[model samples]
Target chain A: MNVGELIERLNRIGALRYEDWRAWVIEESGNSNPTREDVNAAALAWLKDKADGSIWLDPEEEQMLGEFLENVVPKHFDGSVVDALAFLERYGPEIASKDVADLKTYLNSPTGLAMIEKFNGHTGEQIGEMSHFFQQESNQDLSGYQVLRELEGPESVGNTSGSLLAAVTGIMPQQPDTAASAAPAPEAAHAQSAPPALMA
Target chain B: MQELPLAQTHELELIVDRRNRAVLLHRGPELEDYLWAQFDPEHNGLTLFTEKGEPRNLGLAIPKSFSDKLARASTLKLISVSERLHAGRPRQISLLQTTEAFS
Candidate 1:
């Protein structure tokens, strides 16, 4: 089925939350819901179950489920789930049964949380696409660089410079010094302390 | 150059210090640092840098009131680099932008 139908099915199955959807999908499909590795399997099984005269997730329902799974679920799933699954995938059995709490703690750190957040809204395929882009971008490959080069003409250059200056300075035009100081004694000291060579 | 998403409500600006080789983004003082920090610098998704080595400022400018929600809900950051020419040598710079939403 399509994404919308799949999402509707998932919602009807009371799998609106990430945890609930994951549990239901895993339990029903009997396939590990460790990562995207199991999405296709779970989806097929889910479709089969609907068709088997058991739980009925019709075409529209299946489409909803797919859309939700592909888009909304990825965007909103708690960071811990993504980290836990990734940890399991990357570190193997060492993190296979790791608790959500531990995974959460790992995800709270600057680097860990950053990665989790970055990958939160993307499927394995989307991540792969991003990775491919990065690889190509990093390689400074000719074709991509050419595209970039074409995008950087005179107008683009001026606009970029304007943007850079705005970003760095917080976009406020520098104001002339006008306000009276609470204490003027420090002014002489400040000037005297300035780099002597520059003053000279 | 990506438009500053927050520009409608906030008077946001980008500043570059060619001498210091640093780039900065400024929104009015009412917004919190954490809110601004949400903008990531790595992805080039938000901000674009010039090839001539200068920073570009990009972002949304929402009212100061929404600062708390932004910090809690999103990962927004200055992202991307674009290169351009300055005089003869290639100048390379970074971009910073804002993202804001209307109530």
Candidate 2:
């Protein structure tokens, strides 16, 4: 969509934020706030700049690295274009003969360890602790009643309190009978109403 | 339409993961919001967050309940709940899943 149409749609959905607009302009054009007349021209200029490799380190390398990470790596290991660019910025010159083992060696270094720690709040040792906790939890079986209790709605808090009161006072709450309260399906209702001869 | 900024006109699409029952919203390339069912293994209790990143309650009931039904399916489109429910809230979040979603 054109810029005008796009803006109207965003406003309708309440997704527009002033800060976001400002950031986009600053990134696209060096201008913090372009005049209304100049905004469209700035955008077109930004598009042209993006097409050439002026913003990124090298557009060709960026695309190649991004594609390799996305296609060859496991789905979970695949990262954003920003992530790829960051990697290239650090190791572009170091990537001699494009050896995978060299990259693996770099990952084992102190810098890589720090990056991994930042990825999650876990070190190599803490991840083990987390795995153990999940392993123990997964082994425990949940009873059907327990599952239902877990699934109870917000209104059940009051209902549970009322039931506790009834238990203490030796008076039963006006609860519907479990069997009788169950509603039959339409097909079942039709079958039940059929004559005995028809059933035979 | 009047000339508006690109950021102003961006649309957000919401989806729910079939497995793990996480709610995800996408606006542009970045800005992914995840709402998920968090089960406390220690207490055997369940708590669902309405949105990811500094979780806060949107004061809606159905999103918590419907999160269970969204399990084991492809990402379904999440439609906003009633606007009246979100009227006074600062963020104006609508949190409910629609029957239709993209596979």
Q: Which stretches of candidate 2 lie over 4 Å from their true place?
A: A1-106, A117-200, B1-10, B21-23, B28-65, B69-103
The alpha-carbon RMSD over the true interface for every model, in angstroms, is 14.9, 19.5
Model 1 docking category: incorrect
lDDT per residue (tens digit) for residues B35-74 in model 2:
3333322222222233333432221122333334333322
Docking tier of model 2: it is incorrect
lDDT of 1 at B43: 29
Residue range with the least summed lDDT across 10 consecutive positions in model 2 chain A: A191-200
Please give the lDDT score at residue B58 for candidate 1. 40
**Tens-digit lDDT track for model 2 on A1-200?**
22233233333432232222323554556874454334334433433354356443256533433333434222322333222222333233344344432444555578754543333224322211223333222211221111112222211111122232122112222222221101111111011111111000
Tell me the TM-score of each prediction against the true structure.
0.21, 0.20
Give the runs in model 1 whose Cα sits over 4 Å from its true position.
Answer: A1-9, A15-18, A25-33, A52-200, B1-35, B38-103
How far residue A197's Cα lies from its native spot in candidate 2, in Å, is: 73
